[model samples]
Target: MGIKESDIKQDAACTPGLSNFFLKDHPDENKWADCVHCGMCLESCPTYELTSQEQHSPRGRVHLIKSVAEGKITVNEQFMDPVFACLDCRACTTACPAGVDVGGLIEEARGQIRQAIPLTGLKGMVSKFFLKGLFPHQNRLNSLGSILRFYQKSGMQKVVRKTKLIKIMPQHLVDMEAIMPEVNKPVRKKYKNQNVIKSKGKTRNEVSFLTGCVMDVMFSDINEATINVLTRNGNDVIIPNKQTCCGALHVHAGDRETGRKLAKQNIEAFNDSDKVIVNAAGCGYALKEYPELFREDPEWHEKAEKFAAKVEDISKYLYDTGYEKPKTELNTRITYHDACHLAHGQGVRQEPRDILLDIPGVEMVHMPNSDRCCGSAGIYNITNPEMASAVLDSKMENVPEDVDMISMGNPGCMLQMAMGVQKHGRNQKIVHTIQLLDWAYQKEDGKEGL
Candidate 1:
């Protein structure tokens, strides 16, 4: 029902040292008040499902944040765990009858942590490096990509494998490295002076493409497929060379200033295009929510709103544009895993599936709990390995036995699923939905797809 005065008194009494560390920032009270202590979100939360801890659930975390907001509790280590432990998959929001924005609240709470508490030691170092140093700078990120490509193609990887050097490294690191996709030459390199790519026929929609940091470096091929698929559907694609990373990872990790900086840069970069197409789910979610970053500044707020209005996930855009169904048949049984950001954050559920089912000879099987998080909540896999792996185990068990492929929209999901396939030694192919769509489209002309 509702929180009682007596229960609030009890909660205040239970948590000691409240005066020592006051919360300089907290999630909005109105948002926290939306939660009616309904346990409907429990089943949908990955951490709650694994540990069965009340504090790990959305409602419990809301209560904690509410207490902190009311000055009854402090923003300490104990409080940070409940807030950071959330996968931010937005599954709870999907399940909540009250429509409490759990993901937004968690992110806001994370922002509070970054502002008041601030991470230190290795976590702080790494966060500062990537959030500030790398992601916001396209040239530095591409250089790192080049180094990774060297590691992959310079025979160094072969030596590591042949010498059993991988044995010394953590299994997770080794597994992640093993499944690393061949790094294609960065899109900026391939399309050096090619900014605007005209449609094959009449141009239907002109859009700017966001080639995200990790997406461009590791899975550059996906960006290539995205461009091809858009042009195939009569979209004149504009590659904005100046557009930086969408600052999703930075925001998720609670670095608001950096996130906001990158948001401004992106808003400026894609200013000319009314339609900004993003294939990666995380990037799409962040780009669409850029307005949220500038809520307090009316001038930037209006600009951010206008910028976000142009953002669209590729599958959702394709389906909305009435994509042509491929005549070429790809005879295989496949299951679609909904990336949390694409399915829950962006509210894009059916478009990818609609595109998949439209393909000739493609059989779609319903995977149990297909919308559940695959434990790749941005950097959650690396930060919270045990919990991440536990959640991933639940996800992997839901895949159908005879499924030949697991198609999803996000790059993070693709990497996580690839890791799962490697761990279990399954013969399933993990690929992006657009990749598969591009393949089938190419098949019409007697070409094979990766």
Candidate 2:
């Protein structure tokens, strides 16, 4: 049923401390306390820009969350739609003058909603199969990747495409399949016997690498490139075997219990490592936010804070720690898209752009509203296709068509932007920022015939 004005008014009269959210990890009241109903975030919100609905706006959503805490609204379809529709891109938080954490509040509110009304039927089954059954387990992801590799290599993919059988699936999925990156053996599996990949020269730093679950499966090439770049620049990279998924997807999907479980596993997995290096922006941001998952537990929370402190995105890591600049010139005109998590979530805007600029013969074109959400907000394209498409459409308008390649940090953004390119009939190649650096180093090595 829809949230009625009278119902909200009636519930508002309830006791001050009472809450409609009965779950343990309900939305933190402190997050919304500073909102002040300011509309500063409205222009920054993609959904609000499209629908122009109050509930879809950041402050509006914050109001809804606050109302729930005040017993003015109950968790229902009325609450679920706006909350789930959110891209959680962290743009709103960036725009807020008061520095309100709309993303954190949305995630915590989702935790409450999931507990109050759990998913059932096909949606539940699929969600559970992927988030619970598949992600946290590395072997299963490898098996799935193997299957995909066979499909791509064994002529099944061509047959399905030629027969038009792929048209049976949703258009978005079909679009994604059309532009899907070739699946290869994960770096973790390739480097399983070897605990540490030694630096090319004298090692300057030793760091633990989180070869993320889906990242390793779908874009293992990028993972390989990241390691190559790290080692070439005098860093010995350590792959943590015990580490699994970073739990970003689970937390975004409102499965906080599973999110917490994965968080604990990762926290324990990388406990001994001094520095945790991540290539994927989503994974890095999720790793940094581990403390948020353990807010109620002091012991785990403290451990999580320490773990988070050591985590850094690969681009930022290389930039902060001086790396040898490639003498080889790439001569590639590339436009960089700021992955929302990398830019807004982690405040890592200039560091990556600076790294791109430092590359010899690489000309960087500025994408207008470069930090704008690309609608790939961690599988939002899969869940909310129409809005995602609209957001993608809006985002593509800002992408400079003149660039040879479109570079970004997150794999999800790469895939989503690939779809946008395909949908718009554009020819720009989608790539991770680290891949360009890797290519330059490879060229340098090739010139010397090393």
Top model number, TM-score: 2
lDDT of 1 by residue, 254-327 (tens): 88778888999999998898899999998999988887788677899999999989889999899888787899
Model 2 spans > 4 angstroms off: 2-18, 447-450
Candidate 2 deviation (Cα RMSD): 2.9
Give the per-residue lDDT digits (tens) of candidate 2, residues 62-166: 999998787777878899999999999999999999999999999998887787678899999999999999999999999999999999999999999999999
Error of 2 at 332 (Å): 1.2
Task: Please report, in order, the local distance difference test score of every candidate based on alpha carbons.
Answer: 0.85, 0.91
Query: Candidate 1 regions off by >4 Å?
Result: 1-25
Worst 10 residues of 2 by lDDT: 4-13
Return the TM-score for each candidate structure: 0.93, 0.96
> How many clashes would you count in candidate 2?
0
- Report the Cα lDDT for residue 51, model 2: 99
For model 1, what is the C-alpha lDDT against the true structure? 0.85
> Model 1 reaches what TM-score against the true structure?
0.93
TM-score of 2: 0.96
